[model samples]
Every structure is written in C-alpha cells, then in structure tokens.
Target: MTKSVGALTVRTDPTLKEVVVDGKDMSVYVFAKDTKPGVSSCDGECATQWPPVPAADAEAAKGLNQELLGSITRADGTAQLTLAGKPLYYFAKDTMPGDVKGQGVNDTWYASAPDGWKAGVKRQALGVLDHPKLGKILQDKNGRTLYLFTKDEPWR
Candidate 1:
C-alpha cells in the first residue's frame, strides 16, 4: 500500500513497510512500540532492542509538513518521533518489507495505523467513547481521527 502523510511516503509490503522520514526513505513496521498513535518510546539501549523510526537531519526533519511528525525528547535528550504527541518507534526483529514480525509483543507494542500524515486522537479516546462496542481508536498528534482496532483482546 502507498500511504502519504506530510512528506512521508509509507510503502507497506504484505507484512512490512518503508517510510520516508527526515527526507530519507527508511524502513518501519505495521506495529508500534507504544500505545500512542504515531509515536515511539524506545531509545538508547532500548533502541538497541527496538530500533528507532529513523529521522533525517534536524533541518530536513523540519521540512516534514505532516502534523503527526511531532518529536519527543528521549532519555538521552535526543528527539524522537511522536504521533499525536505520543512517540513513534520500530522493531529490530522485523528484517524485511511486509514482515509484521513484531505484531503483538510484550503486550505493549503492536501494529500501527497509517495515520502519520494527519493528526489523530490517542488510544485513550476509546475510553470516553459513547460506544463501548466501538473498540479502540488510533489518532495522530494532529487529533485527526483514524483507525480503530476492533479486537477487545488485542491491545490488552
């Protein structure tokens, strides 16, 4: 699938994907490292376990127009990508495109929706949702609405 957000062009394989960040085309996965929408949390030694969602040079990163391309400071004080104010990250084990090798891991990391180009609500939005049967909603930092994981047991 070809998904675009700001300057990011996400090319998803049957399992994995390649996304453009900081003006460079880097690989990402369908899964995310945290409950936040388009962001990640793993950094430093944590990054050693789960790699970062690569970003381009600081100047280039500023070129990204997608609202979801927000950044967060890591433990080491480096900026990391955040979606809807939440951090974004990638898994180390996913070796190939279209490979969802990190689907459901550690009960925290899982597949991410292609909401990188827009603002979205957080997973927490589902809590106050009028409809409990509606399931979990995913949002980018822009607060734009996006995908909702329907499985009750998936995120838990």
Candidate 2:
C-alpha cells in the first residue's frame, strides 16, 4: 500500500492524545459525506482542500491496531487508507506538522483520535463538581453541560 500519509502514528496533544502522520503534527480527519466505513466522498475540489490519507501496504506504527488499518479505492482510482471505516485526510490549510486548522469545518469534518474516533467530540470528565445537597456532579471536560442524574438517583 504505498501511502502518502506514511506510517500512522499516535501523538498525544497536551490536552488530548490523537493520531497523526508519521512525522507531521497535522491530525487526520474523516469526511461526513463518506458513505460508509473505509469509503471516501472527498474527491476533486473537495480532495484538494482535504487531502485523503494515502494507504501503504506497510504495517502501521507499533502499538497501533493493525485491524483498524485498511485501504479503499477512491474515485480517482487511487487507494486511500481508512481508520476504523473512516477515510483519513489532512486539511489543506494546515501548513505545519502540528497544525490542526481543520479540526471542525462546516460541522462536517473532525480530527481523528488515537482510537480512530472524531477527536474533539468524545466525552471527557473535566472534574468533580461538589453539590452541597446532591453530592458530586459530573461535567464535561470541555465545559459542555452534561446531565448526570435526578433526585431519585436515575440517570438523566
């Protein structure tokens, strides 16, 4: 599989660990238009702005699940690599290795997490909130409101 994205590597951002190209800080992304896992819809001009991650027959970096790595033929007849059924890509505007300028674009694209997921959308616990009467309230790490429970101890 000679992939332009090179060997996929997992890099940890200060706040979150994510998957990146072998030597670039630019995170991989998946397009919402993709019909299914291992499929891609970003072609032509769309591909120009969001370059698909190339697939290589070579193995992924150590510690990465090989089963998660696969390739799919694009409309252009070239094989693009996919992670967990999602075609990977890089944002064209991202000029530097560490740039994630394409994290969220048009609400349709998102950075790829190390676990082959949309990076920033995953739920994370920020910290424990002390409630004088209710005890602790769990909150999203990103400051989003997360419903914990009701007075009857039922999950909200």
Candidates in order, TM-scores: namely: 0.48, 0.69
Query: What tens-digit string does per-residue lDDT give for candidate 2 at 1-156?
Result: 443555667776665456455544467787767866446877888988998877765346854566667778987788787766667888889887877778779988887764455666755556443332354556566433368445665554
Residues 45-98 of candidate 1: C-alpha lDDT, one tens digit per residue: 777756654344322233233544456555565566554344555566765544
lDDT of each: 0.43, 0.67
Q: In candidate 1, where is summed lDDT lowest over 10 consecutive residues? A: 124-133
- Scored by TM-score, the top model is 2
Model 1 lDDT at residue 95: 59
Error of 1 at 22 (Å): 9.7
- Report the lDDT of model 2 for residue 64: 58
